[model samples]
Target: MRHAGRALACLALLSSLAVAAPAAAQDDGVAPLPDDFLWGVSSSGFQSEGNGPDSNWLRYTEEQEDKEDVGASVDFRHRYAEDIALAADMGVEVYRFGIEWARVEPAPGAWDQAELAYYDDVVRHVLDAGMTPMITLNHWVHPGWVADQGGWRSEETLRDFTAYAESIVERYAGLGVMWVTFNEPTLYVYHEIDNGAATWLDAPWLFDRLARAHSAAYDFIHEADPGAMVTSNLAFIPLTPWLFDAAFIDRIAHELDFVGIDYYMGVSLDNLTAARTLTGGLADAQPDGIYYALRYYANKFPDLPLYIVENGMATHDGAARPDGLSRAEFIEDHVYWLQRAREDGIDVIGYNYWSITDNYEWGSYTPRFGLYTVDVQGDPSLTRVPTSGVDAYAAVIADGGVPAGYDPVVPESVCSLIDPPLSCLVPAS
Candidate 1:
């Protein structure tokens, strides 16, 4: 393919990046990122929507303890204009949000006009705010009708999903928004299994359905608007990335216009805390993990552009991190590595902080990963409080990144397993 050769050429030109090489070793501050870089934040539907319609997650929330459903979560469902204004004010050029299938298609063949109009306003507001909208078609929540029909396990589910994609793409084609066919497909399956929607044995069958759905959606989206970008964001598990990729990326590689990576933490011999977060603690983080994730994918899929679709720190309910890292410090540290990845000849075109405001995190709203922390359960006002990250990210957007020679607040760890065999051998000093 055209990109295969480009990937090889990039690898040859950037072999020095094989080590933890900084481009601005002698510079004053970190170098400015490319002018065209896409800077943004993201949110999902079920997680942020308070008065959500019937879906698998809504049902799951009812069955579990410590699982309380707070209405309208920061009220993004109604207050998206305020939120979009907030992101626009920060100077971010993109806002990635989901268009929930459950909300759109309440039943198998029925599509709601008002719900579609609501999203129409949301996308319009995003563009009006000077931010490009990255719209996700499915973000782990499907209509209860689909859930009842065996979710991803049934062939009927894929057919209905493709129809949903078609309707959405045809409706939004004029907006020319970047499209995410599915948000984190690996985790989608994992959640399905975890939520008891499917069994472990159903993974392969589900993947098969998801792959087809994505490919079909990719085609459908393009046919509607050829200029639109389409991809399925992958959650890059720091430890066994190959395992994760095999589970999904390899299956739908050709259909992707770019690689959307949501990298949160890294795994290292010393940084086993990511394991804690992976299991549910959401406590551990390696700020520089973005570099490793980008490098791995750039080399693996050289031809395709890479987008840091989701990357942010999670704290325990808006509390200061136990690591004593401020969100400002955290943002700077991560952005530094993002600049490093770009300097290494990786075609990283965009970066989005995981969320615009805090919302429900799967089972609980305890682990907060928002630039603006909203206390869903504790605060009645549902105030969107700007963390240190808000100003820090704003500064990054304004300056195109930190200044030249600006270093991370935290340095790369020795024996870092973020890149496996190579990272352990040629660790950053």
Candidate 2:
């Protein structure tokens, strides 16, 4: 196995020579991103924000989850400056965080100025830290009032979401923030289903509602701040991507200014172990899958710039992986493929690592996906322990991109379905 530091320097082969014969040799070298490329890290307000508010997520964590209660959740509400400083110290360009709708509008038409002011301070810190704030308007947790009004199931909820989006836009547009209407709307419905808040039959209804919400928000944001770039990022599922996501993706395609993709795991060995086994080992983290994800969207939205709004590896409770793959190696290979995709002429504008510190993952704090691990359930200090990946990411940012001709420390899987024709027809070195 290659050491993480050494992996960053290795150049085994740029690409398979035979694969690129019709075009140019893939083994030559991957090109650097434009000097102005945005490298960033992402975290969600609902997931990271602690000091429990009166929201659906707060209720879920306290009552529904079998795992640990989200006590303080690394105290991001109070410690955002430190976390932002950690990101800024890495020399990152963007910091993607959400403005919690639940927090801002705690009750029906009862806006919380304190909550809004807290976000104002957070955004200010993000800019002062020298990072562009890519603001997400929602990350799945809604006000308890909205849940009582039927969550996404209620037609009234659509108007409520748009109003909330409008309020956020009016306040923050002048701050020069990039806007995300929603984070993984498909996954939002999935979470609701998993939490027994909705059923499978409700997915289409929820999706349609989300689409309207996004469309309304897109127009609202544009009118509020002309030339605002907005998108509702999707979780890029390799399997059934078209089968499941076409309804929403197709509806919102024309409304998006950029294609925001959140890719984590992919289908491998014909089984997505991550889905079946959430024990939090890095089960199906196919770094090369990032290449196909970028390609899938690049081909689909030929003119739009693509941003990796969220991507990272997850270990079980910040434990060392049994597979022996270091976080640094995972990150390097992930970026190497992203660079390869860019070199292949994808209009890739930015990439953000999933998170800066470990926070509550939907229902569990065990699945750790962070450069700096925070033991929310254990350590009283809630120390931000640096993983090898932190250094790996820092070097990547400092250097602009990986070296030209650099090889993936992990080899591409043969016959992988992430991009079927390209996987077998156009081989990777």
Candidate 3:
């Protein structure tokens, strides 16, 4: 791992030098992306699909006044066909979505064949639409029974989670579906802790349980589907350096088949940027931070393919962003960095926009991060309106990259110290 990190550092340094060359003279030529690069969008079962299920999150939203009531989240439960069509239209090659464990296993040892069948249908549709289906076994929404039995802190809950994962793999073995064992295990831990539900606080014990659950599920997924590629996606937050330490990252690095990253907000420990409140300055939320965050992980796992499993900007009540960073600009800036990361040899294989549409954002709909904004409140149409980002993303997908000569509008001085040589401006051909 140390050697891999060192190699990444050298590559970054070289790339920085390369970018300093003149932009016009640069190759600016097109290079073929990886043959298997996955271009897709992501959505969680609880967040987008509006079907009532007895899960910890359902209870959390209902009981917590501060959280948004996600009664009809874009009505994906019924509008899946339309939403999926939107993705297909965008030339997406993959669709990453989650299965609601609570809906599938309403009670202990009881399986809902119908729920499984529903997913089978969804996956089939995705395939028919010329896209692969990437499924997440758990996305922070555990069955209420497991929560009742003490959640992640309890050995019983861990056992149940593994068992559930095994069953899912067994059921969907030949579907050509990529599997994510868990979405952001660290974030899951934080959620448990924040909600006063975690069983362990210390790194050793907490990571021990996480490793146990991930390893068991990893083995089971491969056993069930010989071709399955599985991982536990991490949510990248720039502010949390301790979370990305060697101990925790190395454990995940060893377990995952690929590195799945959920990058949204950028951070700078050197500059000491405080966490912004829901309502704050938009310019302060720069996407450049994503570049460093990706570098942080790419440096650790140089050989493994990296997937931006989740990336998007949030708005308050679907309103125009106060800063110049509109939804369209946010998507464009993020994609630009994504291209830059790949150009720098990060082994990044795919980019999945955080969501297909607006849904319950864990707590509030106010933090709208959807390409197509859906009004969860008031409107009976349960309308899913295309935000400005929709057109921007459509063009990006169609072009298979950002437009030629496009540079992020951030201050050039910000990156002047470490900017890649002007010659590096050429898009990977």
Best by TM-score: 1
Please give each candidate's TM-score: 0.93, 0.91, 0.86
Report per-prediction Cα RMSD to one decimal: 3.8, 7.0, 4.7
TM-score of 2: 0.91
Better of 1 and 3 by lDDT: 1
* Cα lDDT of model 3 by residue, 1-429, tens digit: 655664454466556644212133235732335557678999989898876688888878888887878787777777888888899988888898898999899899999988888887888789899988999988888888888987776788778888888888887888888888888777777677666666445445666777788889988877878787888887765433433544355576676788888876543332223345543533345665565556656655667888889888778887666555777887777777666666666678888997888888788777777888887886779787888888888887777667657777643224311112211232222
Provide the clashing-pair count of each candidate structure: 11, 0, 14
**Best prediction by lDDT:** 1
Q: Which 10 residues in a row give candidate 2 its minimum summed lDDT?
A: 5-14
Off by over 4 Å in 3: 1-35, 199-204, 239-242, 245-248, 268-274, 278-283, 412-429
Per-residue error (Å), model 3, residue 317? 1.0
lDDT of 1 by residue, 1-429 (tens): 644654454455456564234343434544678999999899998888688998888888887776776566778988899999999999989899999899988987887899999999999999999889999999999988888999999999999999889988898896869999999999999999988899999999999999999999998888889999999999988656777888899999999999999988787776777656546675456876788788778767878999999988888887777677888888888888877777767789999998889988887888888899998988988888999989999998999888776767776776777766555644433
- Model 3 root-mean-square deviation: 4.7
TM value for model 3: 0.86
Residue 55, model 2, lDDT: 79
